[model samples]
Target: MSDEDEGPLVKKSRIFYGSLEEKERERLSRETAGTGKLKDGVKAGIAAGNINISSGESMDLEERVSERQSEVLAEFERRRRARQITVSTDDAEVKACLRALGEPIIIFGEGPAERRERLRNILSVVGPDALKKSKKDDDKSKRSQEERQETWYHEGPNTLKEARLWLAKYSLPRAMKRLEAARAHKEIPESTRTVKQQELHKNLRNLNNFCSQIGDDRPISFCQFSPNSKMLVTASWSGLCKLWSIPDCTLVRTLRGHSTNVGAISFHPQATLSLEDSDVNMVSCAVDGSVKLWSMDSDEPVADIEGHSARVARVTWHPSGRFLGTTCYDDSWRLWDLEAQEEILHQEGHSKGVHDLHFHPDGSLAGTGGLDSFGRIWDLRTGRCVMFLEGHLKEIYSINFSPNGFNVATGSGDNTVKVWDLRRRRCIYTIPAHQNLVSSVCFQPTDGHFLVSGAYDNTAKVWTHPGWSPLKTLAGHEGKVMGVDMSPDGQLIATCSYDRTFKLWMSE
Candidate 1:
């Protein structure tokens, strides 16, 4: 072949010039001082280390770098696609995939899927970390969405709204009165207060010794000191109410008519002090569903309040001593007129048997607790439920309206005593007061600051209000303490237990 027609690789000098377009070759030749020998110019420049490559060479270098980057990106995408699976992939299948990827089929004591996840994580670490982070974010978002969907809300009844409003109205003034009284008590000279307390404590210490008398054949359900603190009224599960003289502990009279266990007994607010012994001095409720009123001298009940269909659990005389309130296993609490011998109102709000009842010191409101773990305060004048005591998770066996009027204490089967503030409409305090069900709670009638509670845990506890601190824990009972009562003078605490014994704890 002719040299002029030789291939580009063979005729290097000519091909170098031939590869350039005519204008580009001219520009190169001009730049190289009109030397048309492109190959010689390149050789000389290389020897001098000043070779000036054209812009086309720079463009080729960039293209090669981009191609390498694209190849790396394509490999990464392939690995990602291999790691991913559709929702149809089973856990067993995932384990198989991990095994095929040279990972453990299972970890120590872990199932196949977890092992597969561990293997997948090992592989992901070899790749970009962003992929794993994105996967975690996606999982968290899905879990959060599921939790939100599972949440629910329920609508309460209109009666609950009305009850809330009533509580606001009924408790506000009562709360104000209590706060005022507390402020007044705070103004008493500290030295004088200390002296009074010391004297009270001396009196309490003097009552350190005790004597026991067999008052009944069966267990005593309750025992209360009269308002005058001179007489003791003891009710037994054998359905007998016996009046005894205090200090001496001598039986004075036996009032008997109930054929079943007597569950509760309470004296008239003025009984034995202002009221004559010949008048109706006490009331007792029994399992036979009868509430009987008795005079101090009578062997038979002076009057019978007989409207309940099931067992009567507790009876209370209103603070005014004119009306009677009784709780029954019939799931109702009724208010009775003592002189009229008639039921004036039958309150049916609790879903379970009413266990205990108490009237507020003002005689305007009453609180009832039941086996349903709920208690309600009813405004007697308006015949409306003022507030609901709603935090207990087990049966409430006893409830007491604090003499302060706005605070109510409830003892529950959950072994807790919760103090509810009617004014704040919330539970203000909870005392894990016992190891078993708390059966009864009573605020000191005169102090309005201290409380007494008895429990199936075989103990009675004295609690102070405002902060609801436990002041004392009495642990002498051999069996469950079923009832507790505070003297009107706040000097003595009486408790009855399932062990068929009555105890007097004097707290000056």
Candidate 2:
């Protein structure tokens, strides 16, 4: 198509060169010439001998040369030790190590790499013994922090207090029921559990890319299956959210309200089942900094919640379905009261923008992952961060709580998925999952029997639970996969990609 006919969405392919570009080129040329002259001068000086020097002056010059050589050797040794030392890539850990060594936690104008190098140099100077001591001290500090957070309290509006009380009431019964289910599950015969797991894995091993559908003009940013597994929602960079019939991959509805790229799509917990068609069944957030509530019957949003000065990265429904959670580029996450249609809490703790959020199955806690390479678990009823997930080497893009409520899985830019044990308050396993950034992770809804991950590698993978072994790879997308989710029945997997399409995967 011609550029004129292609409309505003399509850009003409033409390069523009200006006077500033020419000036920059000229400046670079002059700098290059100066460097060449300096190198030539140094070479000439090295080639010449100091034959005019007096004996005393020659002796003093030789001593100065010896000192210069020592300085060079010392620098080489420092670099070698930096390469050998195993300082953590986590900035917080590096700062702690520095503080433990009686050095400044940070220096002005220092970046992460420089801070790590400084820590490495200090460790090399103090030796491995000091590193061991620092680790111990760091562990002590972490324990103290956790202890403080356990009793952490802050005053809030009366609405927030009421919301907290409601959350406590709502979650307590669910937690009891979950515990009961767990106990009953534990009582089951080991052989029976093994056979069920084996069957599940066998089916997952046969998973195939069943079908694909072009969903949008731009990249699909997120996809999710309805709680009933009868429909799917796909959000796109074109600022549209499309709903499709599950399994058949037929477009059902097109919701158009966001004026910019949509980043998240969240179906209410009871949507497609108990929720009425005229009621708010879905929620979406976009780059326009608006969160919109959508109903199945309308093409436009039923309600728009606006206030965020930055884009919202993810939105999720509380298990109770009365509250909503959203993570934003403002380095904060907010809790929204669906009944009042207002933000109830604005939470800030991450050092960088929050990327994704998910509530625990029991509704007592919410987990958030952020660009700061950290995941935090917050108690919904207490309004305090209870667990810090701290091992990923890069920004965390997705977080999901297992249905069993004790394990949290995080997908990160490090191309890994870390599963943390909430009971132990530590990471239990890390899956070297993708060749590129892992964009999304989801555990099967019914029982957390399996985990699915989507990545920029253009692939989605199914992993067996407990063992965390690879079950299958669903590969067909022409671009990076942005999101992955499993159906409520655990019989189907859905993935959306930057290829402007979403696909269904299932056993043949």
Candidate 3:
């Protein structure tokens, strides 16, 4: 073409090197000895688009090309939505979905094929339930196999039925009262709530080292604040269970029950407050494979409930104050009838040692966590498995139920605190809580506003929930913090540390 027709700025293209027999441009353009020739249409398209083509070819070029073609087809199929999934052509579900998508359900002179294709495209954008149904249908066989393998079959003693009914009867009234109290609490004036919350925050921030006493010769493993928050009960590796007056550090009583290290200790919900001192006011479990009941006035155990063949790791009181749930290294947790003084249920489900357990605030459900890196929630009334908490990557060490009735908190050796929602049936929040394993966790008693977690990192931390934000860190321990508890009165924080002492906290 003439320069005048080509554009005023046109210039001659440059060559790669001095012109020779085998020029770079010539070698690139001409076919070499043996190579896969491009298809005529591909060559035409490449020339039309001014695409670059290299001279050499791979030895496995055909295999690679086939693989690439298959991948392209698979991706196309994955993205395609030409056919709709509908159980019935005239079903109202499909019609409702179509209407919601603002699509025409029927077109003039359209057969079922066209209508279905239109619905498919529309549902791809709007998310029809039938799409889920179709995916589930494809997975139905795999799911059935899993269901068959996951069948949990266990039969307790014949008295299990009576125990379940009794639990139902005892827990129903408490559950009702708790719900009513929660409703009333929510209905309170915003001003009243603010004032109460401010008071609590002030008290919590004022929590400081009140007193530290050497109650045990060995490291303390567990510590609990009484229901009245007037005293503290601490168990140690020396096999001693000691009760000391709060703030004063005065030893009130020493109950020498276990011959080995005490692993768990808990007071009855009514202990030292309403129940008589002669009643079985406290329970403790030890590494000696025995659980013992104690009274306020006795230096010896009031009763011995012996059935475990391995170490008893944890003891938890039911909200009804009539049942006790204990975890053992025997790969099981058992429920004890405190009134009848007998073992009511011997439940075994964990693959490894059961380490910790807690009853739901309403007492109708119980949760257990263990060395298996998972936790299970059980229906107390029917003994059926309710939910599985499976996100912890290491052994679960502590569990606590929130007063709100739907949330559970678990501390694990993975150094994380996970909060689960029973209603959502999933882990709702995971707090990267400690540098080492988390050892214990507890939620505030009445309002369930805050959770306290202790860890082997030599720290105890408080976290506020719903958002799960760290509130404060209590870092005075000289060694690993083993146990933590929040008082029902919201006035005390107790922690047992491997430093061989239990510290008390109060505002200023």
Candidate 4:
């Protein structure tokens, strides 16, 4: 009985052990499933590939974007090049090309390069059919610019163009005559020319020793040589205009009407040469706001022209000697009929006080400059501003018309002297002339080749035109040089300084 019971117990024990092993296997399978699910969740949250903590993937993305941009730029360049065209190298071809491109066919200022460029642009846009029609409009614009640049605009009464033509015709023969005379003069022996020049230089050097008589109680502002070059007219800060004998420097007569500084003194073109001394020989303007006409023989003014509300700085005689142009501190310049002594035109355009005025040799144009740092050319006959001289960085103190009448020289507070071509209507040269403000500039009347400038730096400079080179620097003035002038013969240069002296310089 004990053996049978033990056998049953052992069988039961074996079954129970087997059941425990199966339960253990099932628990291990469930744990393995949970761990695999957790691993799958972590992989989904992190990413598809290995995480690049050093930003290598970001650099790869940037490189891809850069490659795309380069392709776009290359395509743009190809399109631009496809639209480009070439212009001809020849003149006629250039003109034809311009015509075809709808640009001007004839040229006033169009150079071959400019015409070519214009043609190229036109061909690029509309092709070549527009070039012939281009000339008429281009000519009109060119003429307008020329008129504006020369400051000779005129709303003519129809006869003015005819008058201009007549004058041009008249000038051609006169210029030819002058050229013939020059050629004849050039034909003279070089030794004789040298001797004449030497003699002129001797006279100029002798002129350096002139007596300085006190003309007024205050500083003298300006002095002018009489038309005959025998007498001198001086204006002073004391508001007096005095006539004096040359070389001797003896005061002859004093014209006193202005109450402030006398800024300008201009002699009539015919005064002391063809006009009588008793006639109105000089015109003077002053800071007292008045312009006075004076006779050489009298101490009183012959006529008073009073319209300016502020100081009148400079007065210029028209080549006709029939009109007077005066610049004033009121930011306006006026043209007056001298014989009638009435204002013919009130020109107001400057932004600051007008300091200097000059009439072109032809008498058809007048230039006005002031503290506005710009200059204006006005057509005297037509009463219109034709050109504005713009470019200076500071106030312009003086303006002078070249003897050729197409060039202008201006002295400015920027310490430079600028040479402007009225024909080109642009600044052709800039002379770094002085260390301080340039007070005056004057072109020689006889020879258009030379110019003179005075500066507040206590120096006077002799300059050659066209090239605008400094020929000489005259440094003797003890104080600021106020004015400079060249003799009609181009032999001597005279400079007045604030140190109460005037010095004459000659080419050594």
Index of the highest-lDDT prediction: 2
Off by over 4 Å in 3: 1-151, 189-199
TM values, all candidates: 0.63, 0.71, 0.70, 0.62
lDDT, candidate 1, 1-508, per-residue tens: 8877787787785455446445554654464443335546666886786976655362343455457557655655554543563321477766655544556666678865566556555555544354456567777999998776332324434443454354456655765787798889889999997787656445544443254566677888888889999888989988788888886788888888988899888999898779887899899999989888888877988878767889998898887676788898888888776655667667788878999888776666889998988888887766667787888999999888877667889999999999888889899899888889898888878766667789998988876555666667777878888888877777667788888878777643
Write one digit per residue (lDDT tens) for candidate 2, span 1-508.
7757775533422212235445655765675567667666655765685244435352344455457557655765665565578989999988877777889998899999999888888877678688788778889999998786443346878899899999999989988999999999999999999998888888888888788999999999999999989899999999999999978899999999998999998999989899899999999999878999999999999988888999899999998899999899998999989787778899988878999999999899999999999999999888889999999999999999999989999999999999999999999999999999999999999999889999999999988889899989999999999999888898889999999999998887
Model 4 spans > 4 angstroms off: 1-214, 506-508
Best by TM-score: 2
lDDT by residue for model 4 over 417-453, one digit each (tens)? 9999987989899999999999999988985766778
Q: In model 4, what is the error at residue 506, expressed in angstroms?
A: 4.5
lDDT values for all models? 0.76, 0.88, 0.83, 0.73
TM-score for candidate 3, residues paired by index: 0.70
RMSD of each: 18.8, 21.7, 16.6, 22.8
lDDT of model 4 at position 119? 60
**In candidate 3, what are the lDDT values of residues 360-403, reduced to their tens digit?**
88789999999999899999999888999999999999998999
Clash pairs (backbone) in predicted model 3: none
Sorted by TM-score (best first), the order is 2, 3, 1, 4
lDDT of the structure predicted as candidate 1:
0.76
Residue pairs of candidate 2 with colliding backbone atoms? none
Q: How much is 355 displaced in model 3, in angstroms?
A: 0.6
